[model samples]
Target: MEPFTIYEQQMQRKLTRWGIRLQKEPNLLERASKSIQNRINQVIPDKIHTTITATVKGIVQTTLFGITYMPKTDPLRGVSMADRDAKAEELLSLYKKIAAAEGAGTGAGGILLGLADFPILIGIKLKFLFELAHVYGYSTHDYRERLFILYVFQLAFSSAKKKPELLHTIKNWPAISQTFPPAADVMKQVNWLQLQQEYRDTIDFRKMLQLIPGIGAVVGAWANFGLLEELGVAGMNCYRMRNLQDKAAELADK
Candidate 1:
């Protein structure tokens, strides 16, 4: 099968596994994914000669055996020069290939991003369900930030070649679905200590979590998910990947 078809099939399995249903309407996640790809492509310098320049001038005779030469030049549009444009175009094309390579390297994470707001967006639809979990005396932690984090983590971690079991954990979710706390339960006092502690602890865990090779994506996804909640998903996905790409590049250099 063609690569795109294979990707589609794999993506479908992931969405289905997460219990996120894809609709016939415009695919926001797909659009966001493309946007990320575009942003990633921007980091690469498309041309090298664009930075260099040369100028020419005339010479004036000062004395019998002495002459002074001066150079006067008009600046040309960098891209207008043949050498610059050719180098830039070639570099830009190569950069695109590199972006594709990095993207291919990020397996499940790519799928999750493509799914867009799978967990969080779907969570909005299932708000009642999460609230129900809390009202019935379940720990609200999982449904709130924890669950949100889990979903984002799924997005980030999913992109690695060595897929994490967490994806599978969330996939066959029924086994631990009830472990999530409900809204009412979260509002209660009995479980405050544990959840509060967990909340505080997760802050640090997030830092450590993001450093892991495959785990960076999960942490990133969770961060994005939280940002989406704070700032709409569209806004969250908008500028975040550029920051991520830079960080990744910096790390690669180290």
Candidate 2:
């Protein structure tokens, strides 16, 4: 790895601060929100909850395992990290607009169309992560790399209470990922129920408001835009951390 320039050092400092913030414990309001979300979950029928869990699990499983789509390798492999990140920011901007449009269209259609937004948004988010991986010069062709993408997804959508552990896992991914089994086995290892519950709890209230008659359109557009923005930040930083660590390791060896 090349030596870090003065600008890179400044960026690294900013990233370190962000990492610390990511691992901090949830505040009181966040805890209260989680409690309220749990109560709402209690009132939802077991059957509906089970269905949603199964649906989400299946969507993720298919995305990871299915042959329907494969991410193209990045053409900018030898480019500087700064250059790659600039391209990544452009991609994020494009996807943000796409997500907001999708959100607005579905949100204006009331409950049924609002339901359709779930899978569509998931697809957009996952596709963007695949592209982000490439921009960072990582190959998603490897199942392990793909698994890292999933961890990034979880880190973005997970509740504040769950963020620390996920952040830690991501930080140590280079070592921890080695112990992972084959792709099929790794898929089975996922706790679908927990994954679904945490994700739903985090977004359900705002999404439910997207089902409302009159204001659904505005709510949906705003919510989707914010969600993608959060994911973009998390994904970029996760990759940035990996790249910086690799550079540091290379320098240490020299």
Candidate 3:
């Protein structure tokens, strides 16, 4: 099947699985416009970062709720690390393991038996990706779209014969372009710009980039551009509504 076909199929499946069936046009555009206007007054720049963090946290909770091996909170979930070197070393070791395991060739049709282990790694990767992208200058919309595109690339990689490490695949911008075209180019730009800015910092941002695909850099940069106060609210509210409906069914069964 064509890559675009695969993308559409994946999107369709995700939407359906999320119980998002629109019988007709929802008032999305109008709602979004109103949200931007109403919320901006309430969404002070000082509060922007916190709101964004909350929005992202909610999205993580909603999407990977039951995805096998994912985590409920990101690895950086609690506590601040005063020792930059120690924190950097820990992140590096974890990324190295993920890269090495993936590089060793997981093969096609591979599935993780461990669902509980996924959330932290995935969440940390996302958090790092968003921060990196922001330092380089991208919008939240760009970050989201790039993330969706990268997910598609990851799925396609599993279909191919090569046992590619996430770092190796991301490092090769040309190959990424084969999977995601112009999106890959945009990601490279974002990643490179961010790296230059953070080069002297004590943060192990580079290792973080090497963990996930470079697409995250694009997404993060994009997200940093503005306050995404309503980023995950709609989807989250939908997820909650679905959970409630399911509970209602269980009650009926009893």
Candidate 4:
């Protein structure tokens, strides 16, 4: 096995700490916020709620199951971890810029354009995850692997109260993924309302600012940049955990 570089060691420590933090129960303020958010969701019209749910469901299915949406990068087979991470960093930087631009464009256009950012941003994030999977040498072509991507998304955007369970599932993904139904069945069973609610709650404050007339452009750009940055970190560490676990298992076998 290759010896861990100082950077790798530090990253491992940071990821470990993050995992611990993720497993902790939500505090009072977080619970209160979640309650408020849930109430807000309830007051939203049923038709609008259904539309959001359907949109999110469609996006998730298309992103994960679409055959034509092959990853841009080839799988990083035989690549060193350092090289893989370097490539991921480059991809993250590129996507952040793209997201910022998209946000700015929509934000400057007022409420209607601001609303359009939802699906566009979802596509960008899902595409980024697919590309990130390839960089980590994972085949996004597999249904189970794509499911892992969804789990990572959930981990990133879920409420604090929901994080522990999602984090646990992601941490034990290899086993948990096996329990999932077939792709079609899984899609049918997806809780789209929950998914959209959690996602909307997570970004509501910043995204609402993007709907404002005067400062919308700046807020949109900044919000999208930050959201992508968060996803980048989450994606990196999720793959890192899987890679490290696989390596350790291989070493144990030897």
Index of the highest-TM-score prediction: 2
For residues 118-222, could you state the per-residue lDDT of candidate 2 as single tens digits? 888888898898889888888777788888988899999998878889989988988998999888889888988888888777778778989999999999999
List, residue by residue over 1-254, the lDDT tens digit for candidate 1.
11223433443444444333212232676456445644644563544112111000000001111211111222123221223324333433443343333333332354444223222232332232222222222333333423433333233322222124334443434445466566445333223233222222223233334445665555545543342232222112211222233334566776
Model 3, span 1-254: residue lDDT tens: 11223433443455454433222233676446445534643544645445434443444433323232232333332222223224434443444454334322321112231111223333434443333222222222433424432332232212111213332443343344356535324443333222221211211232223334434333233222111111122222222232333334566776
Better lDDT candidate (1, 2): 2
Model 3 lDDT-worst window of ten:
225-234
Candidate achieving the largest lDDT = 4
Q: Can you give the TM-score per candidate against the true fold?
A: 0.19, 0.95, 0.21, 0.94
lDDT of predicted model 3: 0.32
Off by over 4 Å in 2: 73-75
Q: Which residue pairs in model 4 clash with each other?
A: none
Return the clash pairs for model 2, or none: none
**Candidate 2 lDDT:** 0.86
Q: What is the lDDT of candidate 1?
A: 0.32
Candidate 4 structure quality by residue, lDDT tens digits, 1-254: 66556766777898889999888888888888888888988898999889888899888888667964568666888776778889999999999999999999999999999999998998888888999999999998888988888888888998987888888887888888889888888887778889998899999889999999999999999999999998998899999888877776777777
**How would you order the candidates by lDDT, starting with the best?**
4, 2, 3, 1
Q: What local distance difference test score does each model get?
A: 0.32, 0.86, 0.32, 0.87
| TM-score ranking, best first | 2, 4, 3, 1
